[model samples]
Target: MKPSTGRQKALAKALTALIPLAPFSDAEAIREAAGQRKLRELPPSIAVWIATVAHVRHEHSDYDALLDEGYDRDSARHFVIDQMNAVLTTWRATRLVEGDEDEGE
Candidate 1:
């Protein structure tokens, strides 16, 4: 899958802002702090996780949707990290296909 685009960022920001006004504008900041990417494709689980974080900060309708979908706290957390790793690996594979070699490999 392609990396999350600027449109995604804007939508995420708008949705997050409506949720409850997170202390931060970009949730990716938190992901990066967790050693994740700032902008990349995410699995549904991770997307839920990111949305959950925003929701926990401010439970809006969208967040409610995630909860309604049966996302538990543990799952949400795990999903974020797992999704990040998955995205990174996929990105690396894509780079390889594009003729980009791994550094020193």
Candidate 2:
């Protein structure tokens, strides 16, 4: 519906860089521990974000829900981080497919 903004592009580049850091190893740790479970290779779609629905929709974070339901704490965090990364990935993907429609020569 809209073109990807500069911010979105920059963020995509950043997340794309972090793709190599998936499943963080002991040598490269995140917030809690070094040897925790690795994250998904692709970003998690935590919520059902419709590209053509009322501009935006409210979707709850699956990660938080998991945390509340006594799920694996580390895994929940990993998914949350993945989802954040997904925002950028999503932007890039959407743009590569449809982002140019809004642009003018």
Candidate 3:
């Protein structure tokens, strides 16, 4: 619902950072906390996945369906956060990888 806390802010920041990379990152937290249960992590790929799914499919209910797909309560929550942050981390890694490519070019 409302990201009213510092943790929420951090999560939002992380998610935003991870968006550009796409097809990578973690995105677990963002998935679990879709309804704002806890802080959202959300990797770039998952972030894009969620956005694309939302845009193409149900609109907004994709996250809940995803959460219920397999993850238990804690597992879903933790994994969502981890996955999202992982996406962010992966995106940074991708940038580094691309930078290396440019250097070669």
Better of 1 and 3 by TM-score: 3
lDDT of 2 at 56: 14
Off by over 4 Å in 1: 1-8, 11-18, 25-28, 31-35, 43-48, 51-105
Residue range 1-105, candidate 3, lDDT tens digits: 445666655555544554544442234434334424321364434443344323222222233456669756444334344344444454453322111111100
User: Backbone clash tally for model 1?
Assistant: 0
TM-score of each: 0.23, 0.25, 0.25
Per-candidate Cα lDDT values, in order, are 0.37, 0.31, 0.39
lDDT of 3 at 38: 25
Task: Determine which window of 10 residues in candidate 3 has minimal summed lDDT.
Answer: 96-105
Scored against the true structure, residue 31 in model 1 reaches a CA lDDT of: 32
Q: Which regions of candidate 2 deviate over 4 angstroms?
A: 1-60, 92-105
Candidate 3, backbone clash total: 21
Candidate 3, residue 92: CA error in Å?
Answer: 11
| Candidate 2 TM-score to native | 0.25
